[model samples]
Target: MSTAPPRRAPLFRRVAAALAVLTLPVAGLVAVAGPAEAAASATATYTKVSDWGTGFEGKWTVKNTGTTTLNSWAVEWDYPAGTAVTSAWDATVTSSGTHWTGKNVGWNGTLAPGATISFGFNGTGSGAPSGCKVNGGSCDGGTTPTDNPPSAPGTPTASGVTDTSLTLNWAAATDDKGIKNYDVFRGGAKIATVTGTSYADSGLTKGTTYSYTVVARDTIDQTGPASGALSVTTTGGTNPTDNPPSAPGTPTGSGITETAITVSWAAATDDKGVKNYDLYRGGAKIATVTGTSYTDTGLTKATPYQYHVVARDTADQTGAASAQATLTTAGVTDPPPGGAVKLGYFTNWGVYGRNYHVKNLVTSGSAAKITHINYAFGNVQGGACTIGDAYADYDKAYTADQSVDGVADTWDQPLRGNFNQLRKLKKQYPNIKILWSFGGWTWSGGFGQAAANPTAFANSCYNLVEDPRWADVFDGIDLDWEYPNACGLSCDTSGAASFKNLMQAVRAKFGANNLVTAAISADGSNGGKLDLADYAGAAPYTDFYNVMTYDFFGAWDAKGPTAPHSPLTSYSGIPIAGFNSEAAITKLKGKGIPGSKLNLGIGFYGRGWTGVTQATPGGTATGPAAGTYEQGIEDYKVLKNTCPSTGTIAGTAYAKCGSNWWSYDTPATIASKMTWTKQQGLRGAFFWEFSGDTTNGELANAIHTGLQ
Candidate 1:
């Protein structure tokens, strides 16, 4: 099914490494709100809690726990006595008296929720101060001796019982440091300190009522308050009680006929161990097996049974029931939703600013019908946190008569670097429509500011995107708001309506023929991250929502098996946050986003974790792995050579070589995935960048053939 495009000579090659020249869409500056640009710093979150000359530099964790994300934010912490402003990186620090404030310096400030930002300064202090907190939470002032916190009362359950004795059980109590034993008090008098959860009160008069309470002590000998009293009286051995026997072990139901269920388990032991196991249908005991196992015959098909084991002594005394396990005798239903959705890449031809060359895809037979092609960025000005060189960054790049070089070399050449070349390429390729994208991972931080003055921001973006200089270059505008109504860098707190307003303004500016789209958050583990973005609220105004589903697993999780880069079913042993791209898509659909309006994501390059020793897939990768551009990770181009063997499961590719491993998409894997995409009734797919694919189009080939 895959098709490779014919090879052609290289065109529009730039000296600099491939950097997408995203453009801001506007003209003459107009009055708006606050300073367009915030001071830039690589690390954006800044908070000051201490003053200088206090002798202690303030150290804290800047947590993005709120729903709103922060692209860039500043924190001002006052220093303690004798603590002077010393050095800083990725931040600009200013000190006045005991007050010290550090602002985000350049294009850095990015703090996402559940993500912590930490920065510290050294100070001349004799020892740790008694008072130190982070974001108002208690902090470890310094590495010092500490005592454990008191444990909470555990859940008490009944256990062994006979005519003469009654036993009590409870859950284990945990302590910060360590738990000493638990004190079991009989009638308020200290009886014993047991290391475990069981206590037997024996040889007491059958009619005597015994009250028991437990308290957990720490390694520091600090005792917690006693648990609530639980009183029990042993019954005389004359009455016949309805004590059920223990449930059999390993109870398994298989080869189930419509009218019967064969339930099997290990033999029940007594010693009170298990006398027998009872099988219940809807909380009512249906059968009890005195032997090892039992078959509940004449059972209706599709019935559900709950089973439990209760051990009984020879005296007919019964122990507490074991945990309940469920069994369903039913017919299998139709197959679940098809595999991961497939996305397609739509880019301007091999031209200036739209540098994503289709040649790599075409030659590799990857001419897949992409649902959408998003043109790089649209500029915004007169909005909150607009970069200072806004207009000049693009104006300077435009040359004589509309024959333009797409970008300028540096910020110094203000009024340079626009997407004019992309306009020509779009004109030549009429079949593929390009949507002008405004804001992305880097520029998304300004959205809060844009929300404050939606009209001005919209006008500016509209002017640039619709400018006649590059008429017909774009079909519509795509809003790549990394996150809205929630945290990305700092937070907006501008309210959820801010996103809807921004989209409305954009829709008004671009008109109907133009596509209005947005890139939504892909963090679906808890559903909190994606829910905060409010994609459903903005869906009515958008043409499609691009789910950025990659970047789920990266070097961040080094020293582990590559999580299913794209998983189908949830599996244990995988971290809670672990989810495949399909999960996110399903969530969107469940949240009311139409499948046709959803565009899936594909990573052109693979994300890797290195320093591995195992050759097989799903094995641990030792760290710290080094990334192609940074640390602890590598890209697909580099990874193919370093670790070539791939693991094929659930239709995706992953590799583990020694202590290093990587999760990536090969030509074969992509093809298999595309089949599921068609079956799922999804719109299409999109990739992060175009340059990361194979030169001969192998990966693209799979996409093309599979989607076809």
Candidate 2:
């Protein structure tokens, strides 16, 4: 599936929640209405907090000054012709032309006498909010009522409980002035203070009972009464009342490297029994394991880190932390040519079904972050490289709106379709290199015949890719033969040396000026697909190899055990051995391939199954899940909302919603993978295609930022 275009379909994701008519302080901006002469019983005020010339955040605060309660309030304002609201939270925001309105959401609507509420929004253009009104009245709240302490916050509700951590959520409290923050208490003792309604508490004992309460504090620092207590008991540990295990000995460092730190220590003793050891970097828990040894990877070179360990008993109670040890990494790995290569595939067929055109790369903000683009499936038919879709490649006309440069493609134009658009994209981002990829799952069968005469095949590809009409559209050629001497949609028996010969000939034909790459199988099992060809020998001929690390498991198995299709590491009950990114990378590295010549493949989409019994892995499923474009396959954009992640394993996230179970990489998981890529000194990362990411290129941005 990773090698084909059939699975990709149209999908989108939304980042939701927010409108308060929040107002900023009018103190310095204008003369305040003195408290000696009050006007209205209640009022709202608008303030433009910060402006970046291009956009600004506006807020409106509504206050109740009278003895009566205010049920609801709405803040309305207008902007100039070029200004508009982009998005809002804490309320519903709508607009009529240049006029904008915000109303409080269900939970934060009511305001007690002498209490206040607020809403805010992000807007485009530099124009400030004007003609502001609150509930059909002037936004200025002239009256200044006597200040009173805020009411107690709603009782805290706990969820996502684990042996070491739990999540707490509560409703906001009412205050005369805006609420500044809430102090979280455990058994009447203050633990942490935060401004948000939720907090995730960690480093707790398992099987132990705890009581939590929240106290609200207003802007003037007046604290409210504590909310009612909510009792919680973490799962695990034999007895909560048992004494904690003794602290482990100071860690002994060994096997030190630039990107990894391996530490071991004597095990700690417990009265009941030792459960797990908690590893900490500063105050954050990095890992938990029952063993006495741990190796932390993805560390920066020439940097010092302080680490300590705590022992937890069967009751989940932890002992005092061991003495910290500071270790500095040795040296940094050399980055690949042109830094980390952030490449993504762009399929010709996408413009046909998914409506994902080349312009999406620019609009989604992906083009600015990426280093390369692989225009896929140029075709390998009749032992000669040919255009996959002539219309999509150079014949299809594009309208001005759909064009990358906002220029229409005419019938008389010399070049059209994706090729012309790519040319325009290159002109816009002159730094990005474009490679024409030939042979996919459907066209891979032709590679066998093409491999029969490597030189002839190389010659055919060179002539096609360098065709003057569209040669400037591509800087190089890429071979995605699926498997040189193994099976994909079909089987190939061109021998192990066939791939090496073809690649060498292609390099010879293209010479030193052009780039050459290939997408290879990632079956890392002993004597698996990787061994069927001379991948190591062919390594020199390629600018880099795209290890198709996904699709190791999917609905192809049908009626069966569910597994993460793109797990970065091996986990317990992994359905198959060596079917993961770790195994593939290790295997390739063991084959003498340099990490700089390897680009880890990431699937922007997800593979899932329906009729699943559990949210966790290793569960039985009836069949492939229903997807927008194809069964069993869905884009990350849709899966993120359709089935929110329930848990994670082996460095990837999985979710189960209703009867369907899905596995996909989130921005967080992608960051983790990018860290691993750095630890392994890999060249960088490339995703399967562009359409699966969010509108802002969330996943792609994760890679770009994580590598730094």
Candidate 3:
């Protein structure tokens, strides 16, 4: 808590003493220790080795090595020449220039030979130290860098239309004595000398592969090994004929009273082989046919129905869905009230789902106004035979029941372990519902395929969403195709009604009471590409439309004046994108999307910019800000402390210190938004997620209270 920097000793002197007596011999060790020739009886282990930037200040974990329980001990080490000791912890350490001394001073507990301990200190470094050891094992050397060498560069292992450029990742190196900067090289030629480890190898020739490597140098001109060579191939230029089949189809037309309806599709031909088809209905995916022809059975006696299928390959990359086809089943009457609502969080890929939880969301009052929870993704592994784009790149290790699971996966499990938690939450809060949202920013690539055969896509989704293994876990489905008939992550050629066809099939299969919804694009910059998608056409079949109004101005636009993430109205000089929520609403309303069926998006967290000297929203930003996910955005919890200035924008209490600025919605801002949602006659207001609120429910409480 103290503002003053802790004091310490000279660099060179401290290093000498510390390294000199780092190791000690116990009385028992001299007695029957195994292998007299060995350097010591046993070596101590350090597991949690982390570098907080650099210097002796970093923390280290230590393990006991000797047979006797350690009642006391000492640890010492010399830092690189330019480094100096600033502070010490977990024990007392005396410093002398480059050398440092530490010894146990407090309580003495039995440190069983194999037991571990942790300690840390704060120090400054200059030159790179030759050797760093813990219990005598050489760890990464202490660095006091002077000059930095360029990092290796290269491309990706594979490329495609969706992923055209290869991204190069490199290891970061620091110099001792004093670091100047870093340089990055591509194919032996300097490309860029960045301060970080990641670089996007853009403007690459599609399908052309490239290899790269990197090395780091310090101020003293000491060079490290050139990183191992890595290779990447750019996604070949757009080749419809050569590309694999599209995403599976979704079903439509569930409420009509008809005995039967025609089912047809645009024959799916792939550059590779088309193995067979998998049909889905009633939330179950069944392998219905081996060839293209499939006659759906078990129709109700005069009830509307829907169906979808997935084309598979030897590698199992399921092609896009055929246009969703709707049929009438016999014997059904009396439709339920309005359709159900699919509520939940939409998160990034690679991150875990347990990261989304009730604890992360609010449901107590206005915030709890949500009737459903939707999880954004499940993987569809890519290759020659790729499922939907989003599904392919998803984390497969996130099994349906591994709550808090944080691993990768090849295929999506029916129910993310988080779904079970959601299932339980529904039981506790029966008024709420749950849905599976597929195809987001990354997953949208598959929607084109889904548009081809809406019925088949719907069926595939039904099977996964309603997998009996987790029966009754979800209430319905939510289609988050970035854009329907229009362009989003990529282009969809199936025409405008492609979305209508898919939703219709899903509606038929889900019956009258199930939930069906879609997140319409908010790109109102031009002729309303979202409106052109004919959301109104799908409204008749969907329960509600989620208007994604956030992410208008992002790090993607390198230009300045970092603005609010979700602005209510467009201010002067605002970039020409649909950066405000109001623009999306007005556009949707103009397109005839009923106000009662439109849900406005509210960001739980705030987007921000750094290097801005100004204090207002439209103020010129000098550079980008640091974020938990994106560099310029900050989560609410983090913003609460680092950028309290965020609370006072527009009478909001947010603030910013240094270059960190945030745009979080406080209880008051939430109240204003709720009032606006009512004035606009919007169906409701939705937050990006349930997380980012205070523990006592301040933000959520405001929303609930304001909504009333």
- Across 1-708, the per-residue lDDT of candidate 3 in tens digits comes to 101111111111111101101222222132233455323223322211112224322333445565555554555556556765444444455657666655543432225566654444445443333233433344433331222222322222322323446656654654433333344556654566655566666666665556766555445443343556666556644443545566544444433333333344444565676767776532235445665545554343433333567777654556766554445444533222343222446343213321444324433342255566666554222211122223212222344343332232234455343444455556656777676666665356577776676677677777776767555766777777766655443445567778888789889877787788777766655345664566756888988888877666643332345566666777666765665777677656544455677777766676666666766655566444555433445566667666675444332334567765556667677778777777666666565665555555565566556656
lDDT of 3: 0.52
Give the top-scoring candidate (TM-score): 2
In model 3, the runs with Cα more than 4 Å from the true position are: 1-343, 346-369, 379-416, 485-487, 646-655
Say which prediction, candidate 1 or candidate 3, comes out ahead on TM-score: 1
By summed lDDT, which 10 consecutive residues of candidate 2 come out lowest?
10-19
lDDT of 1 by residue, 295-326 (tens): 76654343344555555556556555555555
What are the lDDT scores of the predictions, listed in order?
0.52, 0.77, 0.52
Candidate 2 achieves a global lDDT of 0.77
Span of ten consecutive residues with least summed lDDT in model 1? 1-10
TM-score of each: 0.49, 0.55, 0.48
Cα lDDT, model 2, residue 230: 97
State in Å the error of residue 300, model 2.
21
